[model samples]
Each structure stands twice: as structure tokens, then as C-alpha cells.
Target: MALDTGMKCIKYLLFIFNLLFVISGCVLIIVGAVIEANYRTYLDFISSSYLSAPSILIAVGVLIFVVGFFGCCGAVKENHCMVVTFVVLLFMIFIVQLGVGIASYILSNDVERFLHENMLKSMRNYDRSRPGVIKTWDVIQHDHACCGTNNYEDWTSTPYGEEYNGVPDACCKEHVSGCGRNIFNFSQKLNDINKEGCFDKLKGDVEENVTILGGIAIGIGFVQLIGIAFACCLAKSLKRQYETV
Candidate 1:
């Protein structure tokens, strides 16, 4: 027996939902990749665990494509089994996405303390011969156009800061060899050096990015719920049709 008009509409709606799922999957993949890249730049200031959220997002995104295809096929073939499987898989993805959203929010709140402590520890390593340490600090200082963790004064406690008599050369507003030497106080050479601290700058940027990630995850999760509903209704219709046959 053919489906009633309402059932026919539900079938088409399920197909539309599956298409939306595929598009959202692409969006998640892009979001995950971009956030992961941003996190790498600040790896020195963050814990390695932070990377897992984005990595999972990418994985979930890939799984969505496969599950969405199954949903599409189920809706087209009017197969109760396939539609039910799609609903289960989508629910699993929804749970994962929700978890990621919550984790990102918690991480965002803890970022300030985490960055302050880690940045200070990393600053002490600046004077060492480690190229990675040197480059990380220099990149942060130069790229952000800021000085030490809290201020240029924060560097004075470090050997490199004492050796330079002020802050690292990367803290100079204009890149001049030895320009940062002997420069102390904002009044000494107001235009010559960056008196602002890197902590505040980095903290603000990181929090904003993390918040965006959380929003995306939660947003996608809610949309998945709708797709799950549509799939379930269609599965019910198919089951009833089979009973009458």
C-alpha cells in the first residue's frame, strides 16, 4: 500500500533533514580544523587535552556523512531497519557534540589561570638554548605586540630579562637590534617598547575562540535532535505500512 499524503510529506522531510545533516557535517569539519590550528599556535600556554575536543569534532563530522547517507537510503527505500539505525547513530553524535560543547565552556572559564601559570613557566625557559622555547615566546611577543606575561616588568624576574636590562628584543615596538636593552618604565621610551602584557591579550583571544567552538557544537547538537525526530516518525510510518501488507 502507498503512503498517505501526510506520510509522503514526512518522507520528503526526512530526505531534506539528511541533506541538511550532510551540510552541517561539512561545517563541523571546517570548524574543527580551524580551531585546532588556532590552538596549536598557543600550545605553549595550554594543556594537550584541549586538542581532543576539536579532534573529536572532526571525527564526528566524518561519521555524520556516513550516517546521513544511510538515512537518505532508508527514507528512499522505506526500510524500517535502516531508518532506526540512522536514528541511533544520530543520537550518539548528538551526545558527543553536547559533551564537546560543555567541555569547551568549562575550559574557557579555566583559561585565565591556565595561561598565567603556563606562560610564566614558559617565560623562564626563554633564556635557554632551546629553539622551540625561544621561538614560541618570540612569536607570541612579536605577533601579539605585547611584552611579558603581565607586563615588561614581569620579565625582570627572569635571567634573560635581567641580562637584557629590560625585556626581549621582540617586545620592541619597532624591530631594532638591542632596542629593548636598558629600556625601563613606560616613560623611558613610550613609543619604543610595548608595555602591555601578553597574558590579557592571549587570554581574551583564547576565550573568544573557545566560546565560538562551544556555540557551534551546541548549535549542531540541537539540529541533530530535529533530524532524529523526523527519522523516527518516518520509521514508524514504514513499520505500519509493512504490518498491513
Candidate 2:
């Protein structure tokens, strides 16, 4: 009777853990979606492949939801096969996530250089189209309170820069009415032009966020230990109970 009671306690405890796992997965999906949406402009500016991170988060979240369901069933039914499968799958995912988190942490540290390089290349292509590229730059500059990838000097080398002879109106301070004139020589508007670049600001923010995310992933990966131990114990207890009967 004591053993049966202990087994029941383990089963319910595993159920609660798996339930929380499912909830965590859902939270990850929402977080990924929010990040992707917030950075869509940057994604559009850079390689589309940059989107894989958020997409993977959503995919992993769904996978966790499914796995948690299996574990929940196994705990509820005290089925040895279900519990074993759950333990194996959960451990595999935990290992995979640990590796992914570590790699992300290391790679995120140096990603800013790559962002700067790619952003410079993307800037040259900015004026290739009229409204398309123009709007992206305008929106990026306006929203970020930044001028160029590096600074206003970035525009000076471009063909469009030669024709326009000045920075975009988006670079002007909020209070400035019209920054249409030759901003470089215009001493009055010089004070209004935002010399700060978007890449530095954006990259710094992203790096901080990535570090936080990597830490979170590593922390969550360790949580699988609880599921694995509980599932294994519950399976063994169930097996023993069946044999003794």
C-alpha cells in the first residue's frame, strides 16, 4: 500500500511537471513570434535566413507540447512503454537544446561584425529601387533615430548621394521641419542630423537579448532531468507492480 501510494505521488508530480513544460513551450512560441515581428524590418534588410531562429523556437515549442502530452499520458496510465519512450525522447531533446544554446551563446558574441558588413552591402543596393528600398531606409532611420548603417557619411559614397547632395529627411531631429537642403554644409541643420547609426544600437540590443535567451535555453534544458528521472522511476514502479500481481 505504501509503494502504491508513492507511485501515485510520483505520477501526479510528473503530470504537473509535464503540464508546466507544455506551458513553457507555448510561452516560447509567443516570444518567438513577438521577436520576429519586431525585427521584421531588420530581417527584410538582411538575409532572410536570419528568420530561422524564431521559426525554430516555434517548431521546438510545438515539439515540446507533443512530447509533454505523451509524458502526461504515460504518467497518468503508469504504462511502462509510454514512460520509457517519454524518457528517451525527453533526454534527446534536452541534449540537443543544450548544444544549441551553447552554440548560440558563443556565436551571438561576434554576430555584430557580420551585421555591420552585411548592412554596408545592403545600403549600396538601397536606391536600386525607388519606393521599395527608399521606404525601408526611411522607416529604419526614422523609427530607430539613426542616420545610416554607420553614419551620414555612408550615404556620401552612394550614387543616390551624389544626386541628392544631402541626407534623407528622416535623419533630421523630430523638431526640425525640413532637412531637404544640403545637410552636410548646412550648419543650422547640422545640429539636427542624427549622426548615430542604427547598426550599433540594434546590434548592441540584439546581443544583450541573445545572451539572455541563451541563458534561458540552457536553464530550461536542464529541466528535462526532472522529467527523465520521474518517467524512469514511474515506469519501473509500474513494471514491478504488474509483475507482483
Candidate 3:
């Protein structure tokens, strides 16, 4: 049951590819976790369906790592059953990953609207004491040194407008102890207002992160195509062993 030179070459190639696949899977898991953990500021604007994508990638990454092990073992042992199963799993995972990437790209176009709406809505809920989304707006506004969704005046539409009767303290000028106290008199404090908005910055950050994730998906997808081709070739070569016998 000797394998021909070509079959041996393909088999070895498949093993090497699977080893790389394992590493790739581990990377995806790490990347996904980071996205899920640190994306709170941006993801808070996205719906649950879009937000769950990172978690799904984490799960798929773990699965790919496990499945890749089967592939390496099958290629080494020249086991037909294992090789076939590995090929099937790789193909399925490849489709899923590509789909995720495409979907992410599509969503990016409309994400600006969601971000604008969410930020405006969140302005009304800005409070340090309350939990969940209460702190999200404050953190983004304070850390990013911006106000409202578009500018200082965006807050005027929210109930927060009446509650604070002016801009939040987070929108104050530097070194001004009671900068926001003049919130009522925008004309008097024309030089003190923070004219920049949070929407553009937040939108930029979200686009950047989503672009990275989509790139990961596309990159892995290409590798899966190579792996699938190698597996199929090696599977065919396995039949050569029987022929020789």
C-alpha cells in the first residue's frame, strides 16, 4: 500500500496547512475576545444581533482549532475517514466565516444612522450612578472630549436638556472650574463650548474595528480554500495506495 510521490507531497502539504490553521484559529479566538471586551463604547450603539458576532467568531475559532487537529492527524496517518471529515468541516467553516465578513461589510454602511440615533437617545440617560448604558455616554463624551451626537446642541432634543437645563459638565473647557455653569448662556461662553461632536469619532472607531474583523474573516477564508483543495487532492491520492496493492 505504497503512496506515489505526488500523493506523499500533497499529504505533507495538507499537514503543514493544518498546523497553520490551528495557529490561525487560536488567533481568531484572541481577536474575538478582545473585540467583545473592549468594544463596549462602540457596540453599545449596535443591536444585539450585530454585537453577538464576536462571540460567534470565538466559538468558530475554537471549533476550527479542534477540527484542524483531526486534519493533521488524518493527513499523518493517511486515514480516509478522518481526511474526508476534515474536508467537510473546513468547507462549512469557510462558508460561515466568509458570510460573517460579508455581512459585517454590509452593516458598516448603515451603522452611522444607528450610531447617530443611539448617541442622541443615550444623552438623556447620562448618569454616573446608574449602571449599564447610563455610564456609556458619559465615558465617551468625557474621554473623547466631545458632546452629544453631533455637537453641544444635540443634547437639547433629549429630556436631559430640561434636566440639566444646559450642557453636561463633561462638555466644559479646560481649567474652567465651573465652565458648564455658563451652559445657560452660550453667547457669554462662546469661546468655552466644545464644538466637536462624538458621532464622527465613535463612528470612525467602529468602522476601523469592523474593518479589522472583516479582514480576518477574508484572510482565513482564503486559507481555508487552500486547505480544502489540499485535502481533496490528498484524499484522491489515498486511492493510489490501494491501486498499488
Question: Best candidate, lDDT-wise?
Answer: 1
For model 2, residues 158-186, the per-residue Cα lDDT tens digits are 66566677777888777354474477566
Q: What TM value does model 1 have?
A: 0.78
Sliding window of 10 residues with minimal summed lDDT for model 3: 40-49
**For model 2, the run of ten residues with the poorest summed lDDT:** 175-184
Structural similarity to truth (TM-score) of each candidate: 0.78, 0.82, 0.80
Off by over 4 Å in 2: 1-3, 27-42, 127-140, 159-163, 175-181, 184-188
Name the candidate, 2 or 3, with the larger lDDT value.
2
Tens digits of per-residue lDDT, candidate 1, 93-203, equal: 899889989999988878788879878887887765755567777888999999998988888888887787677889999988888877764466756988899998888
Ranked candidates, highest TM-score first: 2, 3, 1
How far does residue 176 in candidate 3 sit from its true spot (Å)? 6.6
Output the better candidate (1/3) by lDDT. 1
Candidate 2 residue pairs that clash: none
Q: Residue 162's C-alpha lDDT in candidate 2? A: 66
Candidate 1 backbone clash number: 0
Candidate 2 lDDT at 203 equals 92
Residue 116's lDDT in candidate 2? 89
How far out, in Å, is residue 236 in model 2? 1.8
